[model samples]
Target: MTTQQDIPGRTVYIVSDGTGITAEALARSVLSQFNLTFSRIHIPFVDTLDKVRQAKDQIQAEREKTGQLPIVFSTLVIPELVTELRKADALHLDVIQTFVEPLRAELGISPKEEIGLSHQNMESLEYKKRIEAINFTLEHDDGQSNRNLEDADVILVGVSRSGKTPTSLYLAMQYGLKVANYPLIPEDFERGHMPKALQPYKNKLFGLTIQPERLAEVRNERRPNSRYAALDNCRYEISEAEGMMNLENIRYLSSTSKSIEEIATAILSNLRSY
Candidate 1:
C-alpha cells in the first residue's frame, strides 16, 4: 500500500510524461485530494531520458528555493529514469508513477481485455454516415435535388461571416443531426427578407450574427488585406444583413468571441427547450 503524508504547503510538478492532455486533466482532478495548497507546473511531452533529467534539474532548483522537496507525479516513468531522478537530491518527494504496478493485482484485468473493451465500445456506435450525407446534401445540393428543409433537425442562415459552418458541423457531429446552412447574399439583404431558399424552413431556421469588429477580425484571419477582411466593409455588410433578418422577425444569436463548445452547447440547449 502506498501512503501520502500531509504537507501544509508543497509544490508539485505534474509532468505530461507522454500522456499529454489526459495527464494534465488527471492532475487537475487530484488536486482536491490533498489538504495542502500547492502550485502545479505542467511539463508537457516528456518522451525521453534526457527530458526526464532536465525536468529533475528544474524541480531541483525550485526545491532549493522553497526549502521543501517538490512532489513529482508523472504519467510516464521507467525504472532506469527513476534511478537518475532520485540522485537530484530533492526533499520529501513522492513519485506516484511507481504505484501503477499494483493495477494488475487489484483490477484482475489483462491489457488484452482492456483493449477489447475499448474496441467493443467503438463498434457499438450507430451508423451516422446517412445523417452526414443528409447534411451535406442540404449544404451543397444547389436546389437541384429538392430535399425538404422542414425535415432538418436544425437550419442555419446568416451572412457569410456568421457562425454557420462551425455550428452546423458541431450539431451534425454531436447530435447526429441533418443540418443546413445558407448564406444570405447582398441581394437577399437588399430585399429585406429571408432568402427564398430559407422562407419555407422559417420555423427551423436560425441566424448567427457578430459584432462588426469581431466579424472583421474573423474574416481577416482567413483572407488578410482584402476587401472581404476590411473592417468598414464588414460593418456595412453585417448591419445590412442583420437588418434584413430583423425585417422578417427572424431570431439570431451573436456568435462573436464565443468558443465552439459554448456555441454548440447553447444551440443544443435552445433546441431542447423548444
Candidate 2:
C-alpha cells in the first residue's frame, strides 16, 4: 500500500461573531473541515462600528498564520459588522449563512420558513418527563410498587446486585426513560418466572445480566469481604439468574465490562428498534 503523509504548517482559525455558547459549539463541531487542529476566538456582541472593525482586524491577524480562516456569526445580525467582515480579504472566509439556506436550496422552500423543533428533541422532552415519573416511584416503592409502573416507559429486572439500581437511574437521568427495576430472589429463581408483580407488565419489561466475577467485584464495593461478596455466591446467583431468564424465554443484555452510559443507550435503542 502507498502511504501518504500530511502537510505541515497548515491551520484554520474560527472566530465567533458573538459570545453565545451555542454559536461557538456549532463552529467547534465543524472544525473537522480544516483537516488540522484549529484555534478559536469568541468576540462578544457590541454596539459600535469601531468595535466591529477591530474584530475584523483580529480575524486578519489570525488569518496571517493560516491558509484559510472561517468567521462565524451568531445572531450578530448587524449589517455594519457583516459589511466589515466581507471586505476583509487576507484569506478565504465563510459564515454559516442561516438555518433556512439549506432548506430553501434542498427543498425549494422560501426564506421565511420554519422546520420546528426536531422529532428527536420533542421525544427527548417526553422521555425526560417519563424518567422523572419513574424516579419518584423507585424512591417511594415502599411495598407500594408500580402504582405508577403502568406509566413507566420501561421496566428492568435482574438478580440483586446485578447493577439494577444504578442502571435504572442512569436510563432515567440520561435518556429520560422512566425505568423501574425489581430483583429476582432465589425462591423466584427456583420457580423460573419473573416476579408475579412484574408479570402484569411483562411486555414493558427488559433484563440485565453480568458475569459472576464482575458481579462479585461490584458487590464487594458495597459490602467488603462479606459472604454476599464472595465469588462462589456470585457464581451461583448469576448461573441461576441466567437459567431463570432462559427458562422464562426473556431476552436480556449482558452488562459485564460495559459502562452505565453504554448499557443504558443500548437498552433504549434496542427497545425502540423492537
Which portions of model 1 miss their true places by more than 4 Å? 1-148
For residues 145-192, could you state the per-residue lDDT of candidate 1 as single tens digits?
Answer: 326666677777777868887777777765667777777776776676
As for model 1, its CA RMSD to the true structure in angstroms is 8.9
- How much lDDT does each candidate structure score? 0.67, 0.65
The regions of model 2 sitting more than 4 angstroms off are: 1-101, 110-137, 140-144, 190-192
Task: Tell me the deviation in Å of residue 64 in model 2.
Answer: 11
The clash count for each model shown is 0, 0
**What value of lDDT does candidate 2 attain over all alpha carbons?**
0.65
**Per-residue C-alpha lDDT of model 2 across residues 168-216, encoded as one tens digit per residue:** 8777665666677877777876776777877777777778899888888
lDDT, model 1, position 128: 52
Deviation of model 1 at 29, angstroms: 8.3
Best-fitting candidate, scored by lDDT: 1
